[model samples]
Target: MTEMTYRQALHDTLREELLRDENVMLIGEEIGIFDGSYKITAGLLKEFGARRVRDAPISEEGFTGAAMLGLRPVVEIMTINFSLLALDQIVNHAAKIHGMFGGQLGVPMVIRTPGGGGQQLGASHSQNIELYYAFVPGMKVVAPSTPADAKALLMASIRDDDPVLFLENLALYNTKGDVPDHVEPAEIGKAKVTRTGKDLTLIGYSRMALVAQQVADRLAESEGLDIEVVDLRSLRPLDRDTVIESVKKTNAAVVLEDDWLTYGIGAEVAASISDGAFDYLDAPVRRVAMAEVPLPYAKPLETAALPSIDDVVNAVHETLDAVGRRR
Candidate 1:
């Protein structure tokens, strides 16, 4: 295994896929000359040339619709905040084409974008709007926290014969982790058990999954609590079975998300536990989510609005306390 940053892992995977498949091409604003907003496509233009590394105008809807018709196009929307501009194409056409045409046609395209707050891009630019795409039935959403999973999941998404929304967290770009030397594509709808515990289950995806790990370590050291951490790698085809099984074993749960609380991904997780493990649960399912407001531009406000390690730790403690399991 080789240690690499999350951004480098994504870049390497894209480069590997582009070389491996002739049909796979990239499309996005400033992806060519600018190397992408986050440099995920840094040197692709030079290697693949203009034909494969194509750039588009600032028309998300237009280009997204056009890319959907092409052969295995991986389009980057700059950021999830900007993805709102392409919602009509994403929700109405790309998502519904296969079903609308009775499976005769499929939009085998991947929409890659970063979300979550940390750099203080203000309310307009900094927001975890993954719930928008995750709510849609036709779109497949996956958010990987580690460099290894990032490469594997992206490889899988590019090959899938359906529309996929690859959600990246802005805060995770610089984070480094060990990536496999011979990486394999990860299954799209699976949750990974990162840590084992019996006191409570802490579930999260993307950035929150990383945070959950941190919380688990703290709880283990400070409170002598055995907290299990489940990373929800894929959001759309959510691995409810894994979540339910973990909750059943732990008998308690606390869902952490970078998005807002109401109607967020946590709500679905909590509901799934209630449906499948209601009798097994020893306490109410809890959630830790961003403040339900436009993420503020100021540093302090943004930090407060976004969910943190402390917030997750507190939620876990509260859930354990509710079940009288706190040490």
Candidate 2:
């Protein structure tokens, strides 16, 4: 086991996957010569040559569309906000092609982008848009939390037959974790139970999972609350079985998402848990998410707009209160 930064883990995964699969190719802005904006594709251009790891111009929509023509293209948009500029290609061509063409055509493409607001990148660049791509029917939106998840799911995403939107939180790039050298790809739609408990379940994705762990620790230390934490790694094609299974055991839930509260991934998971695990529920399904609005540029206001440790802690307390399980 070796500790590696989140960005290095992803870069290693891409390099490893490309070496493993001959069909895997990459195309995006600054990916080859510039070594990617975050250096996630660093050194690939030198090793694999320009054929496999090629760079594109400023056209996010155009090059991305061209890259998804059939090959398993790993197109890395500089930022998630920039992906909206290429929405037409992702939605119409890459996403809709497989199902639309009666399985004749394939869209084994992975479009990776950075998101979330804690970096003070302002409203446009820092917003979490995981739910936006999750809303699309044919796309698999993956927002991995740990270095392991980032590495494993990226390889999985590259190999997926459907279009997979891999959202890497910009703030998570420098975060370090122990990564296994002989790790295999994890399934896209499966949810992992990060921390096991009998009291309540805290569901989160991406960087929010780190915050969830911190929130879980405080609950266990101070309130003696044992919380089951689920990392909803794949937002779309959500692992309903995993979440429903947890809700069945705990009977209480608090979903923590970094996106807006109105129609965030938390809302979807909450609704599903209610539908599938209704009889087991002892308290109302509580959701702690970002405030619904454009992210503020000011540090304090930006921090306020983003989901925090306090929100998760308070939500857990409220959930326990509702269930008469507060200690």
Candidate 3:
């Protein structure tokens, strides 16, 4: 095992995939020359040349539409917000091609973009709009919270025969974790059990998954609460069974999400728990989500708008209280 930051893991995995498959190519603005906005594709241009690490104009729709046609293209939109420009191509053409054509053709492409607030990029740039792509039927969405899963999931996304929306959290770029020296591609639709506890189930994905673990550990130390954490690795083909099973065991749940509460991923999760494990639930599922307004540019306001560890902790406490479990 090798400990590395999430950025390094993603870079290494992209490099490894490029070497392993000749068909795998990266296409995006500034990816080749400027080395990407977050530097995830740094130095790849010199290593692979212009043909493989191709750079396009700053046009999301044009590049996205072009990249989807052929090759196993990893199209990196500057941010998830910019992805909106290519929504028509992504939702109408890329996503529906396989199903619309009777499975004769498939878009083996990957749209990799970073989202979420932290650097004060303001409301327009720092939005966590993953729910948009994950809502589409033909798109496969994967968000990895740890460096290890980042590598594994990226490898899997690159190799898959479907169009994948690879969600990266800006806050997690520097986070460090152990990654296997020899890793296998993670099963795309699976959820991971990061921690086990009997008191309540804490579920999240992407950045919030890391937050869930933090809350679990903090509560374990302070309140002696056994909190089980379920990380939803894939959002579209959400592993509802894993979530339901965890909630069934714990009999209570608190969902943490970086997106807004209205029709957010957490809402889907809470509904899943209600549908699958209604009889097992000891209390109504609680959801902790970002403030409904657009994320603020000011650091303090942005911090206040986004969901924090305190929000999750408080939700857990309230859920436990409702269940008659005083922690």
List TM-score per model, in order. 0.98, 0.97, 0.98
Query: Could you tally the backbone clashes for each prediction?
Result: 0, 0, 0
Q: Which clashing pairs does model 3 show?
A: none
lDDT of 3 at 13: 93
lDDT of 2 by residue, 1-327 (tens): 889999989999998889998889889999999999899998999999998998998988888875435568899899999998999999978889888889888788899999888877888898787777899899999989889889899988988888899999988999999999788889999999999999999998898888888898888998898988999899888999999999899999999888888877888999999899999999999998888889999999998878889988888888888878987
Stretches of candidate 2 above 4 Å error? 67-70
lDDT of 1: 0.92
Please list all clashing residue pairs in model 1, or write none if there are none.
none
Q: 214 in model 2: Cα distance from truth in Å?
A: 1.3
Error of 2 at 110 (Å): 0.5
